[model samples]
Target chain A: SQQGEEDPQALSIQEGENATMNCSYKTSINNLQWYRQNSGRGLVHLILIRSNEREKHSGRLRVTLDTSKKSSSLLITASRAADTASYFCATVKGDSSYKLIFGSGTRLLVRP
Target chain B: DTAVSQTPKYLVTQMGNDKSIKCEQNLGHDTMYWYKQDSKKFLKIMFSYNNKELIINETVPNRFSPKSPDKAHLNLHINSLELGDSAVYFCASSQDSQPQHFGDGTRLSIL
Candidate 1:
C-alpha cells in the first residue's frame, strides 16, 4: 500500500491569493486524489490526477503529478475564506480494488 | 438531501461497552468505506465494502467489525471499546473512478 505525506502541516494565507500544497508518496500509484475537510466535518473530494496524467484542472483547482519524483501538488487559485479546511492527499494503487491510503493533511487557513 | 448520512452524529459510551454506528448512502453507490480520524486529524482507512463484499481491511483491531447488509448500508460495531477508540469516524461512498462522498461523521467519545 502507498501512502502520501503532505508538506507544511499548517498554512495561513490571505484571501484572493493562490495556495499551493505539495504531497509525496512512497510507491507507484494508479491515481492521486485531493480531499478537503472542514472543521468537525467529513472529508470532501476535491480533485484527482491519474498516474499517466501530468496535470489536471478543475475551475480554480489544479493538480500536478510527477511519476518520476513520486510527488504531486495541488493549487487553489484565488482562494476564498470558504476554502479554509484541512486538505489531504490520497493514493490509489493499480490493484483491482481502488482503496485509498490517505496522507496526514495540510491545514489551510484562508484569513479573510 | 444528503448523499451519505450517519446516525447518532455524536456517541458517548463508557469503556468495556459495545456500540455501533450506522451509515447509509442514497447515492446508489456500490462501494462504501469507513475511516477513522485521530486526534491529530489524520484520516485512515479502516475497512471497505463493495456491494456487500469485503474488499479492504486495514490493520484495525479485531474488536472492531464492519457489517454490510447491502450495497447502500455499512455499519460499524465495536466491542469492549477502549480509550484509544475515541475519535471521529467517517462513512464514505463512491462510484467507479468517481470521487468519494462522505457523511458528516460520528464523533465517538469513550470515557
Candidate 2:
C-alpha cells in the first residue's frame, strides 16, 4: 500500500521559476526521502529528512517534514529546464521494516 | 561505476512465456530490492533480500520469484507471464536500511 500522496499531479513552470510539491502520508515514519526520475529511467536520490528534523536544504532543493501533520513538501528554487522530471516522496515507516512506501509522484515540467 | 545495474533494459515477451531480469549491485550493500511500476505510475515493492535471504516480500503472485545469489546480485523470474505483468521493474540496493539506490529499470512488455 502507498503511504504518501502528492498533491498537484502535474506542474508546469517557466525557467528560473520555483516548483513546489507537497506529500502527505498515512503512518508514522522514521524518515522521508525525495527522489527524481527522468522520463522512464532510474531514480536519483535527491534529499532525505528524518522525522526528528523539521527541515533540510541541499543545493537548490528544500525539504520540510511535519511529523505531527503527517505531511512533507519539496521546494525547488530557481528551477531549470533540466529539472523537468517526476518527483516522488517516499516514507520509511518503521525502523524494523526497512521498506519505503512511495507516493504516486508529481510530474514537473520546466519550459525553457 | 554504476552502483546498481540491471540487464535487458527493455523486455518483450508473449503471454505464457517465462522471462528473467537480472540485477547486480557494486555498492557492497547487504540489502537489495525489486520494485514494479505500473502504467499508472504507481510504484510498489515486490521483494527485498539481505545477504541472499528474503527479508521483505509483498503480497505478490507466486509466479513472480526473486532470487538473490550471494550478496551482490538479485534476479527476478516470472513464470507464465500475463499482460498485467507488463511494467517497469527496478532493482535497488542500500547500506543496511538507509536510502536505496535504484537501477535504470527494465520496461517489460507482454503481448
Candidate 3:
C-alpha cells in the first residue's frame, strides 16, 4: 500500500489566481487520483493520472505526475469562489492492486 | 438518480450504543468501500467489499463491521461505539480501474 501526503495543508487565493496543490507518495503507484470535497460533503473525483503519463488535463483542471520525484501536482486555472474545497490525492499501489489510499488533503479557499 | 446513496445523513448517538449506516449504489459496481474522515479531514479506508465478499480490512477495530448483503449494498455497523468514533463516514463504489463514486456521507456525532 502507498501513502499519499499533500503539502500546504491550507491555501488561500483570489478568484482569478491559480491554485496549485502537490502530493507525494511513498511507493510506486499504478495510478494517482485527485478528488475534491465541499464543506461537510463527500469527496468528488476530479482527475486521475496514470504512471506512464506525465500530464493530464480536464477543462480547467490540470494534473502532472513525476515518477522520478514520486510526486504529483494539481493546478486549477482561473479559480472561482465555487472552487473552494478540500483537495485530496489518492494513490493505488502497483503491487497492492486493490485498495486506494487517501491523503490528508489540502484545504483551498478561493476569495470572491 | 443518485448513483450512490447513504441513509441517515446524520446520526446522533450515545456511547456504548450500536448503530448502523446504510449505503446503496445503483451504478452496478462490483466494489463498495467505507471510509472515515476525522476532524482533520484525514480520510482512512476502513473496509471494502467486492461482489458481496469482504476484500479489504485495514486494521480497523473488530467493533466496526461492514456487511454486504449483495453487490449493490454495503452497510456499516459499529458495536459499543465510543466518543472517538465520532466522524463522517463515506460510502463509495466503483468497478475495476474506475474512480470511486461517493455518497454524501453520514455524519456520526457521538454524545
Which numbered prediction scores highest in TM-score against the true structure? 2
Docking quality tier of model 2:
high
lDDT tens readout by residue for model 3, B11-33: 99999999999999999999999
Misplaced by over 4 Å in model 1 are none
- What overall lDDT goes with each candidate model? 0.92, 0.94, 0.93
Question: How much does candidate 1 score in TM-score?
Answer: 0.97
Across B25-105, the per-residue lDDT of candidate 1 in tens digits comes to: 999999999999999988888999988999889999999999999999999999999999999999999986578899999
Q: Sorted on lDDT, highest at the top, how do the candidates line up?
A: 2, 3, 1
Residues A57-95, model 2: lDDT tens digits: 999999999999999999999999999999999998775
Name the DockQ score for candidate 2: 0.80
Error of 3 at A26 (Å): 0.5
lDDT of 2 by residue, B1-111 (tens): 988999999999999999999999999999999999999788899999998899999999999999987899999999999999999999999988788999999999999
Top candidate (DockQ):
2
* lDDT score for residue B9 of model 1: 100
CAPRI-wise, candidate 3 is medium
Error of model 2, residue B34, in angstroms: 0.3
Local error of candidate 2 at residue B102 (angstroms) = 0.5
> Can you give the lDDT of residue B86 in candidate 2?
95
Model 3 lDDT at residue B91:
98
Tens-digit lDDT track of model 1 for A1-112:
4378899899999999999999999977889999999998888898888889999999999999999999999999999999999999999888744578899899999999
The fraction of reference A/B contacts recovered in model 1 reads 0.72
Candidate 3 lDDT score at position B85: 98
